[model samples]
Target: MKGNSSSLRVSLRLLSAGLVSEEVIKDDTKLVGGSGLSLCDSNDNSKKSETNKALRNHQVLLAAHLEEAAELAAMIQGLSWALKLVVKSIQFFCDDDSIILDYVTDKVAPPNESIVVAKLLKQLALLQTSLTSCQTLPLQRSDDDINSSSLIKLARDAIASQTTWHTNTEEYETCPDCYAHVSPRHKLEVRSGYFHPICFTCIRD
Candidate 1:
């Protein structure tokens, strides 16, 4: 749900007064056999509300072959989703320079041949319609920052737990992406072999 600009600003001010900081998080995982992706908001401490998904099958194949520009498209998709949850206009931080550059400059669209890129463009267009303001910036990872290390560990743990692909016959698992209980009908199995039980609403959007 996108918040009104005035209300969002006020809320941020209130939160800031209490020393409660919020950051929009975008992180990608390149594993041995597959990739794990997460887009979320980090509240103070290690607590996070995130949407985690894995790439598999055709999506994994497409991601594997994506050039730098195409990869940026994928990251944009994640960032768009994260922006929807924010009440206040905020800066988006990611490790990818190409994405930040394109977002900041409003660069040219990605090539038509990449289906994933097309989807990302569509998502961004929708996000623009709903958002009042947003800024994209780069995030540098450092080993010295305890907070950064903890976030990395938290993302790794989520990926580790949700990486396996499961079928409808399998037990129900809560989707990290939407934070909803997923039943078999809405479960999606990735080609990399991890079972991500996503809700229908998330899969659709």
Candidate 2:
């Protein structure tokens, strides 16, 4: 899905692995990057109605090693945003088979060190019952499809923008992958006295 902030126009095209790709239009414009987002502290009431306000607050950060965890975070982020927009039903297309799907759908336990994964799993559990309808399906990770090709370019542009942002900003605590600023809420503890702030999009890439 693609949304333009200036126009409040949203268009859906295709999806995979918790990310939505929209057909680029003449007026396609980028949404504001890095708004506030919080995951674990949200309540059911907040999920149902306060998503915009909540997202305007903090970004959730994960470890560099936790790709599945990041995908889960992106799934939560997309679902919460859709709910905020009052979307009734949702279809998610994932590019590949992922253990994260099993974790969310089957209640499979993550590794003991996967604290972020565990938290995201719990969040997905709450979300599954909250939505009217939601489906997660797989798509072949190939550029043969037009939608897939657009999605790949979108991903590359995002990565480029992130790299540009990092290059122009002053050095501080940042995500190792994207180099975006890492707030306290954006960090996930990976090991003893170690913290890495990896955003979901970067992790997905």
Candidate 3:
């Protein structure tokens, strides 16, 4: 009877181990069937949404920059190119078709002096442009100056003095690779910290 009792106890222990292993296997299978797939899908959707959001934001930024560039171009044409010919009619140099001819102001001036004044005005108006305020300094010279008394002289002096204001020097903004003066008139104007063109050529290396 004691031997039979020992044999029964060993059989019970073996059955218990088998039962525990079966339970553990069921739990692992349920986790794989239920939670694992859902977790993967959730993570994938999160990444997809994140990528979609980034793309939309990039598009919005690009559109805003394009609009800004268009405005700058229009402003340049409006203020800079508008001054190129004085009026809607005078577009080129040989335009001698009855635009207002300004006369000399100095009393008893020599012919050479008068000619020199005209040449000066042409030089001043070279790079003419007004600020964005849609209001520019009056083209007429101030009454404080002796040369301002004559309207013809003032107009001539204005066409010369008003247009010649240029941007900063070449040393303030030079291309690193080529060491050339980059034209500031293009889009992507980098005005940060004394204005320099951050060209793509500089970034290639």
Best by lDDT: 2
Candidate RMSDs in Å, in order, are 13.0, 14.4, 39.6
lDDT of 2 at 70: 47
TM-score versus the correct structure, for each prediction: 0.42, 0.47, 0.15
- In model 1, pairs of residues that clash are 51-177, 57-191, 163-194, 164-194, 164-195, 165-194, 165-195, 166-195
Ranking by lDDT: 2, 1, 3
Which residues of candidate 3, in runs, are more than 4 Å off?
A: 1-64, 87-205
Report lDDT (CA) for all predictions: 0.40, 0.43, 0.22
- CA lDDT of 152 in candidate 3? 22
lDDT of 1 by residue, 108-194 (tens): 555556566555556555664555655555554462144444434433334445433455666455554665655546766432323
Predicted candidate 3 versus true structure: per-residue lDDT over 57-167, tens digit per residue: 222223323322222222222233233322221111101221111221122222453343333333323333222112211222232123212322322222222112245
For candidate 1, give the lDDT. Answer: 0.40
Give one clash count per candidate, in the order shown: 8, 8, 1
TM-score-best of 2 and 3:
2
Model 2, residue 170: displacement in angstroms?
15
